[model samples]
Target: MEWMSWTVPTAAFFIVIGLILLGMTTWELRSPSVLRKGLLPIATTRGDRLFIGLLGSAYLHLLVIGATDWSIWVASALSLVWLLAVMRWG
Candidate 1:
């Protein structure tokens, strides 16, 4: 990680993402998700929703970083909320 020049925030981001993927995989093995309709027009499985949420979060972070001077943690929190919302009721 040091050789990669990984900063704390960058490391933390990847760690959290890795943990989320692990947890989701475990949960899926225990109780597989069925495709279902949510707020998103198309029916989606858990993996689909997860992908969408993460992709959207990336975009959200980029938008905030590019358009504003607020702390990156702000984007992190907002992305977390967005991910949870999509997972729960997308």
Candidate 2:
């Protein structure tokens, strides 16, 4: 079960982040902030939803890579910034 040492913690971390984002999204939907009220609103267009999903996945994967030290944290940070930029600009 050598993989568990890696997979378990990674899975737990992903779950935690997923939960955090879910709660944040829910809160934003019920009463959106300035940013959420703009792009990522509850009634998002299909393209917006796809963009959000892809960015969200990329963000989470980059976070995992950051945690595992397979790469620099800068990449993950930049990925997060990229997600925000796309959500804002798209």
Candidate 3:
């Protein structure tokens, strides 16, 4: 139908996000200690910060991007919750 224009731009936007995530992942791997601190400065170290950031970022992107598609949004939200639970329990 007339989905070409919308699809192209949406795909491009998602691709850019993917690239940014890739860069962040690479940086995180190289310097995980930098991410240990929680955003609010809890007693966390660089590793914890990185872990939380990764989970939070995924949570945010999934919530916003998948808003129109509730199923995906829920999946993303659950993942975030799961990550937080794991961190707290372990």
Candidate 4:
């Protein structure tokens, strides 16, 4: 445990991921998902859209960091917006 070197952001990130997974599980149990087409141009289930959104957000952050001098907060905001859009209408 001492060797793990867990920082606040790292711990928070993992905690958020865990919470998202738990929430998705609960939502699934409450109401089953069906595949449907959206702005993504392909049918996808809720889980699929979630995966895509997360992946895309990662890339968006990386792209912003690597390609510009803007603050990470901007990238984070953009990623959050993208994630919400995908989850809502992807």
| TM-score against truth, every candidate | 0.89, 0.42, 0.34, 0.94
lDDT (Cα, 0-100) at 50 in candidate 2 = 43
Query: For candidate 4, lDDT tens digit of each residue in 1-90?
Result: 368789998899889989999999999999999999999999999999999999999999999999999999999999989999999999
Q: Write the residue-wise lDDT of candidate 1 on 62-81 in tens digits.
A: 88888999898898788888
Q: Cα lDDT for residue 2, model 2?
A: 55
Candidate 3, residues 1-90: lDDT per residue as tens digits?
564456885788579768856875787698763323233546665446446656676776676666665575566577666655545442
lDDT of 3: 0.60
Which regions of candidate 2 deviate over 4 angstroms? 1-3, 7-12, 28-71
lDDT of 2 by residue, 1-90 (tens): 354455885787689668856866787688755423444446564345445756685877667675776565555666666666655554
Candidate 4 lowest-lDDT run of ten:
1-10
TM-score of 1: 0.89
The Cα RMSD of model 2 versus the native structure comes to 6.9
* Number of the candidate with higher TM-score, 3 or 4: 4
What residue runs in model 3 are displaced by over 4 Å at the alpha carbon? 1-6, 35-90
RMSD of 3: 8.8
Clashing pairs in 1: 39-90
Residue range with the least summed lDDT across 10 consecutive positions in model 3? 33-42
